[model samples]
Target chain A: MRPSKLVPLAAATLVAALAAFPLSVARADDAGDHADARPAAHAVHDLWVTVQQLAGGDSAAQHPARPAPQAVPAGGPTVNLSDLSHPPDIDAKLHAIARLPAGAVRLTVPNGQARLGDYSIGSEQTSTGDLLVLHGNADVFGTLRGNLVAYDGDVTVHSGGVVTGDVLAIGGLVHDQGEVDGEVRTLSAATPARTAAPPLSAGALVARNAAGVVGVVLTLLALGFGLVLFGRPSLEIVSDTVSHSFARAFVTGLIGQILLLPTFGMLVVGLVLSVAGILLLPFAVAVYALLVVVGVVGGALAVAYAMGETYTRRRLARGAMGSPNGYRYLVVGLAGPVAIWLAWALFGWVPIAGDLIRGAAILVTWLIATAGFGAALLSRAGARESFAGRIIPPEALTDEYLWATPQFGVPAVRRPGKR
Target chain B: MSGSRRARGGRRGGRRGAVALLLLLPAAATLHAQTMMDASASRQLHGESRLDARIDYAAGTLRVAPADAATLYRLQLRYDRDRYLPLARYSAADGRVALGVETTGGPGLRVSSREHLAQEATVALSSRVDLALDITLGATEGELELGGLRLRSLSLRNGASRTSIRFSRPNGARCSRASFSTGAAELEVTGLGNSRCAEVALDGGVGRVTLDFSGDAAGDTRARLDMTLGELVLRVPRGMGLRLTSDRLLASLETAGLTRRGGAFVSPGYERAMHHLDVSLSSTLGGVSVEWIR
Candidate 1:
């Protein structure tokens, strides 16, 4: 709080801020390049893949990073670190790993492999099967030799182990507890983007903004339609019930996302199959058609929600009826149809955006539907009290609710608007 | 904020509204309120994934960043061999003119600049200056173009954008290995009659590329085309030994004194067979043809 004393502190703070670049560059020495890429972005697409898996009735949750985490097999890859003294059974069995920097290789199960360069010796890295080795950390354990590239990772060399190429983990941290004769080419770069980069083009800016607006509108409409179909009062009851429970809603949402996405992909596949089957397989086309309808409804619902939020009439009417009843709604009025159609038109023209919208629609549908269910249950009050309550479900959150009761699939009724 | 303004106004609260109403307040005019910092043109080299480079003296160095990642291009000119000066920073974020090479380096360097319509980083120079351009184009549609400059190495990463670069100035000097993979972009050397190189391999994603020899090759050249799904076209001069291979290759383009031996085209330069050859080819999928021109 001392005004004069703040000078040193200010100077120190500035120094610290300026030091970020150099420190980051130095710290990047050990950090995982792949790790920095992050798996969050993949979640959306992979979840859709999982949805496809789930809709086809296949076990998609089994795969990691999907909405529904698939249960890993009982006999998963065993990593007994205590027994890490010996080389993994190369021919015995090892998990198929690929593009692993040139020194991080251990075998235990059956897998495939591709190695570039030579990490053990100079010029290039050797290769082996199942386990792909990159020469970031150039140390070979046991007796392994093959073509693996020693790019930028460190290497670990066991006493009896040997490699064939140069371990070029130049800027990366190199543990010299190994042996290699190949030269190291040090590639140094100046400070990278210290701040967030500006958008390269105006169109990209417009595109991102548009996507956000469209997504928000879609999310709101889903809630509105749910209210309209189930009736206002019931939706209120369910919504309140769900608001009381945080744990239940999170888990249910996670599970639902896992189940719904891939359904569209499978529908596409089914459509393809139906085309192949011609008129003989009417069921495929019918199923595909059903999915299309749901997609259309979901998108229309989103547009309607955007409209209702932006428009005064619907916002006021919905407010009187309460939030839960608002969601039990659908597209209405000329403006509603036009907005919805415009969205559809944009999506149709851009295939990439269209696919993205399809996925977004599915996600939005699930989000609002559950939220709707929670709202209805909340207004009704203990609508699912009959069911055994281990804990509160998604329909009973303190802030927002989705279910009229604790059970997952149950939908609640709507209520009438206030005078 | 409104409440605080009212409190400050005390007896003359009405005046506060007038104060707020004024545009560009006298007091505020002097105050430097916080605002967004300007985005200085920055091209930090994201270490390349693939290194396939060569060296030959041409005009200026063509610095390329060939990935979807926002890449800032730079120029490192040195007073001596070990130093450099910063030129400019550019990014291939827009599918519209992301990179353009101005033909205004130290004279005798005829730099014809053209920024293509694609999200890739590239700078094409067609001059006669003995300058070295270090390029770092990524593997995501990341491409680098060199018409008359010397290169060191061409690097690439896994699943990166395809890279295709053609080394021209066919008769000037020769280069070493030009390795490409993942991303699809290439260097199509043309107008170079009898030019040659050490080794060339077009890996997967190292897509539809061509190393055209307009007239002829310089010395004995060695080239290999490795493609998973794209195309590769090589133009051989008038007469020379030709060698080409793949899962399937079509010799629709004619090459004199070239006979099929095994699955490879045998055009032995025998030495320096990449001079004075006009080879124009389009592969439907993945096709490769290597021939030695006169």
Candidate 2:
């Protein structure tokens, strides 16, 4: 958030203060004029500041600024939310949606996941970093991640390139030539003699979030179904096989996806047949559910398998997971997300990955689900002996993979001589 | 069974073959005889005979393993400080070996066991009755406790055997080598203080090998492996200086976190490590993984 934007916001605070306590507003106005009104070097989430002001009312206006403002707590913020778009433009809509106060504020986006159709949207990386959005007029500052879509304001993309999704920051500052993928549009707004552009909204954020959570749950549900059907380690191993074997998973998943279109098409056609063959109509629906249940079951098995291997090696070796009963899948598959979500809820309330933690978890789950589904299709075809059943320990790999480095200096002998 | 009815031109082997046929009840017994012959004498085997020894050695060059067992037995040579020819017709015995290998490491001699173990001990050796040769090596290079020594250049060919090799080191070090073959009988060379072998190979068949080379004494270490079938694994120090190169046939090599010096520069990770190793590893069948740790 820039200093210029803060000036009006500061004045807006004064106006609201004046309306409430008249006497304190007078005193603040006088003090405001006397003091050079230097901008606060550090900015907080704009929405948090807004909610603080709204809740605090007039007395807070005269008081010194909060050392650290806060965003909405876990239960979610209390907003005077309107069912319809209030003020109608992107800027006002964003303001209305976020409801930040007139001054410097901090806005931390929820990293929660959502699911839309077959796609899992939102962060699944259970990290601790939050996407903190500082307040400003046209151009915004602070960390931006995930889908930063539809901002009519000319925002400067920073050096820290956005990893995924679209970038649409219009009017004032596109100074930072950061990466952008999706559509970006710009329009001039007339009224204010300031560099204001038409405001753009992000229904996708809500849609994406909702879609992510749903996707994750559905995927998990599908996995659970498969687990129930195929039995343990076998199911889990297959699911993970797809995930770890990205190429195989993708190819197999594509086949699955391709086959699904026709299955659904057949279902649609089956509905027409059901009208005539009413007795067999029930069988059709049962078959559809059966296919879905079977698919999810298979997917879960694959996920479980991959998760198990990954867990046994990286975690059990270091004593991170300490169960002797061997319920590795139950522990890692189920517990990883919950642990991350709780951490974010507890510690994420501060800074860092708190807000973004949930999002990361969602992303991870989404990937897992995709792999699970692919695995279901693969196993159904009984390709168990298909040149892919080899278990090569990571250390033996010859290619430079994603997280591989000569650990010569990595401190492998942490406790070798202790015993 | 060695036997040959003395026909017209039959020579020394004639009587030897005749004796072999009579002792056919237990072939192993005939192969392992209760007699002593000079390393220079060409003593024909009347029956199966085996030579089990009790020895104490310094670091020298004598490679005894299963991969080359068949080849060595074919050479049947004399035993001692002479031309070390290999062959199947070697002396045999079933007895206990009592010998100790002196420690051969650097100054620290930091015996990691809080202290040192019983520096000397005795172990029994046999070929027909005993299933496998279990060898144990320790941290510091110690003297060769060769209680069971028979073949001049012995090679072990086992169908399926347990060669449980154990090693101890003051420095908590572990190193091993394997070539690209499976079902190659396992041979554990224990008491690392005084042992020397440039290369170790695993040819074919099913086998489990355990090696403990926990010392920096060896000048330059190199392991060559050629596998056509079955599983092979080598666990060593993660930080140990190594040069790995691979020619993949069917098996996928995974070297996730091994510390090595020279080789086709593989981006430090599992895939590259597996690919760049100079092992003749092909997976026409089976799988293999090599782990490094110190």
Candidate 3:
């Protein structure tokens, strides 16, 4: 058969086998119960005694209580007399013996074979039928027409031994040296004796978590640096909004988040009602995702910048030596948030405290994001807008000219040395 | 009769009437608590050409039909205010419109022991646009008439609802795939041949299902039906060549006017028919019957 066809057949067989496993186990349990309820039968006991005697180098004549053969009925089926104690059908008898529970039977085949640690079939001898061994080793040096099977014991066929049928070892091993006309199969014994590996050390686990946190922090820093370089203006506006009107921006952002779903719903409704609207849905979804991302990054930057501004202002008032430049602002803004996040990640391993700190960080980050989004909206997407809704008069630009506006085409002449 | 006897009888009647009045108060209060809610929305098609639509509903009677050509889709809803109403969203961009309706209460809302809310939606698909449709239902009765529409793909899912979907006319475009899955629902799809899809799949749990393949076949089609503990009935047109294979455990199969060949059942003259259909059924704990129709 082709491999493809064989695969499904093998799978089906496996499924059937698994389905029957529980039933077979239950049957084995019942048989065990029955065995416990009764003493060993005399015939079986005598068979074991004969095996033991043979194993001890006793001659067959020493055991006179060997099982007697039963007479065959006239004109009945022909019975093999070589082993009168066994059934006429040698194959059937061997199968039945094999089906018995482990250790239930100790078999010495040929009725009088020499019981070395291993039984051997001589090279000069040719067996007409299959050889069956139970809980014992079998060594074959001669030819046989039928299979050689061992249960819970190994089977070895040395050089010059030829078998026309299969060689099988159940819960055992096979060592084949001679030519076999059929397949050789062995089933390994069940395994439950292996030990499991020990758990990792506490230090190793902590190191792993720390590595994960470092990786995340590095990635975030790279992204923050990119935002600072390319999106400076928008970032500045959001940070300014957070510094000036943090509470109002936060409330607006919260409201916007709450209404986001409803607005998307409305958009979908419009799309369904208008076939032409379908073309715009994808763009709208993309824009929405972009907005959220920008809001979050801007909010984080704003928080960082606000902190930097406060610290710089305090230091400058105290006559400290530090340049307050764009680069300093960017570095402080980026590092502040990253440090907070890293702290959150580290404390996350501290049982209850870790959970509380992580939750607080998440809440604070969300608020910052909303506040930044509100700020972005208030700034009209980074466009400059006058609070008074009017341009300042040129006269107002000159000192001591607040009351008198500067006239066009003429420079304002300050009063000569009013000091 | 004496005057005192008459007076005592009147008093006893009055006491019984007062007791009856008190018993009816709670029922009256419940009736007063129910409120009627109405909502409707519509939008016009401008430049978009394709639509992706999803309708999610729970615990209501829903009806869907093709709309007249003036708009892309229109929805009309009437429900009890005490219960959740469906929220609708429509967005169009990049030549694709996504329209969806979900219950405001979402899946967490517990269905109250009251009358089922009534909700009806009439959607008109523009012949100019191709569509992908998805519907999810929870314990809601649904009727869908989806025919004469340009469809790309369609999917329907339901839980403990009786839903019937029909295609009264052939689809304008060839559909890629159509599928339905339900839990303990009596689902019937008529004119499946009109769906003009290369593949159709149905999965049902503990409910009766009828799939009628009676519409004109746009091309050769394959169908897969899987059920756990439910009866399935299939109707196939006699003129079409059919090959049916069933994998069943603890279940039986009955075929009418079909010959069992190898592991599959085939209709007579299947080899010579112009159009062919392949059906696969996997069912447990129920019977499948296939009947040929002209």
Candidates 1 and 2 compared by DockQ, better number: 1
Candidate 2 ranges with C-alpha deviation above 4 Å:
A1-230, A254-262, A270-278, A314-326, A344-355, A381-419, B1-294
Report the Cα lDDT for residue A419, model 2: 21
Best-first order by DockQ: 1, 3, 2
lDDT of 3: 0.64
DockQ for candidate 1: 0.02
As for model 1, its CA RMSD to the true structure in angstroms is: 27.7
lDDT of 2 at B272: 35
Which stretches in model 1 have alpha-carbon errors above 4 Å?
A: A1-336, A339-419, B1-145, B150-159, B162-168, B183-195, B205-216, B229-241, B247-294
Report candidate 2's interface RMSD in Å: 46.8
In CAPRI terms, where does candidate 2 land? incorrect
Off by over 4 Å in 3: A1-419, B1-28, B94-101, B106-114
For every model shown, what is its TM-score relative to the native structure?
0.28, 0.22, 0.38
The digit string of per-residue lDDT tens for model 1 on B1-294 reads 597776777747657667675754866744532111111111222343222222111223233422223222222221111112122322223211122222224333212232111111123332222222343333233334444443333333324334334444442445554444445455444433332445545455434556564443454445555554455556665554445443434323343455566754455453464322222223333545555444
lDDT, candidate 3, B12-31, per-residue tens: 88988988889889878777
Over A33-121, each residue of candidate 2 has an lDDT whose tens digit, in order, gives 21232123211222333445655652223343322222323333322211111112333434453433424332334552211001101
Docking class of 3: incorrect
